[model samples]
Target: MSERLLHLGHEVVALVRPEAAEVVGAYEGRIGDLLDPRTLTAAVTPDIDAVIDVATPLGDQAADAAAIAALTAPLVGTGRGFVYTSGVWVLGATEDRTADEQSPVDAIEIVRYRPAIERQVLALADEAVRATVIRPGLIYGHGGGIPALLVDLARKFGAPRIVGDLGVRWPMVYIEDLAELYVRVVTNASAGTLWHGVAHPAVAVKDLAAAAGAVAGVTTEPVVWPVTEAADELGAPFAAALALDQSVSGAAARDQLGWRPDGPNPIVEMLDGSYR
Candidate 1:
């Protein structure tokens, strides 16, 4: 996202760990930790044109709330944009419905606070800040995120295992496509709007498992792991999220900001492209 914003000729000031400061290449960066309210405040200085939070809250509820508030407080009344990163899990299992920005939330434990955080972000518009919520789907690309786990499992155990049955699916967006959407929202979106960052509304977990199997020279059949067992192997909340059947579209991003997601979908790419 920082790179894309820089590509659009915007001067980006990224908040990264002290060790990561050298890695942003040409962009200016503030060395800080997201978990610390003081560091977050140090990063969101008055000179910043916009603040994009891509960090996940990493502490207890009170600390997370405090950190989030510290991050959002500096932008109030200043009118500088605040782009809060949330995810599709906040909308929970969509069943047969294709969720949009206005959909009701039934979040898993990991992201239960996101709905409230998003509401707070939107309400910041009342303070004259152009606040927006970016609810990205399962972000996968460059040999990382959840699909990488499938790749690893396929290599080690032949058939890749999915958390649930073949019917389960997840909304997906390639990293580049998601980055472009972020740029669009930063430059063009109106205040108080929420945008879904999904490209393909849904992709079957079995299909991704098959992609992993293809890379490993194994059969495409998937083994369904029990959710409870998965919870132990992973975490309860993360396992539940993996098993969720979510489908969502980036229609609001498309219609509102003329954003187009041209990056390759994860299923095919995981099989034949970068994964190799």
Candidate 2:
């Protein structure tokens, strides 16, 4: 999305490691490390217009909070925008209902730290910061994120392995559409607002994996793996997340920010386009 923001004519200043300095073509890139507090603090200097926190920490919850506080503390009270990237996993198991921004959130164990950080992020509005949160559904594309696991395993073993019985509902969004939402938030959203970056909010996992199989030109049936074994292979935290049945409402984003994701649903694009 940083790249999209740059294309939209925003002067994007990105932090990068020394080895990656060549990757950032323009926009005043800087040499910095995510693990170093000084690097992040220095990067969010007063001259910067906004600070977007898309970089997530490792499994340490405390470390995550500390990293966020370090990055955002410098931006508070500046009335500058602070866009925090959150996820729908924070609204765990929304199977019976389509959760909106106002819906009560009970995050799964994997992302329990998110809700608190979300509250802290939104509270920045009170401190004169134009803070907003975007909770994206399963983000798939660019040969990365969660679906890469499916594609990788499928390539190796014939089909993508299912985490559970393939009955779980997985809300999804195409990567490009997700980038568009970020650009929308940067261009038009109000402070303290929350938006769901969802395209198809309740795509069945079976269909999702089937689409992934098609990406690899494989027609193999999805083999259901026991939750414990999935956890062992994909890690407990991530497997626990995959086991959730979630659906979210993108109406708030569409209505407020005029977000129109003019792209194919993730399943279609994954099967016939980018995922290949």
TM-score of structure candidate 2: 0.92
- Give candidate 1's root-mean-square deviation (CA, Å): 1.6
Worst 10 residues of 1 by lDDT: 56-65
For model 1, what is the error of residue 154's alpha carbon versus the real structure, in angstroms, after optimal superposition? Answer: 2.0
Report, for all candidates in order, the number of backbone clashes. 0, 0
Q: State the lDDT of candidate 2 residue by residue for 154-195, as single tens digits.
A: 777798677877788887888889999988886778889888
Assess the local accuracy of residue 238 in candidate 2 as a C-alpha lDDT between 0 and 100: 83
Number of the top-ranking candidate, with TM-score as the measure: 1
Error of 2 at 18 (Å): 3.9
Residue 271's C-alpha lDDT in candidate 1?
A: 74
Candidate 1, backbone clash total:
0
List ranges where model 2 is wrong by over 4 Å: none
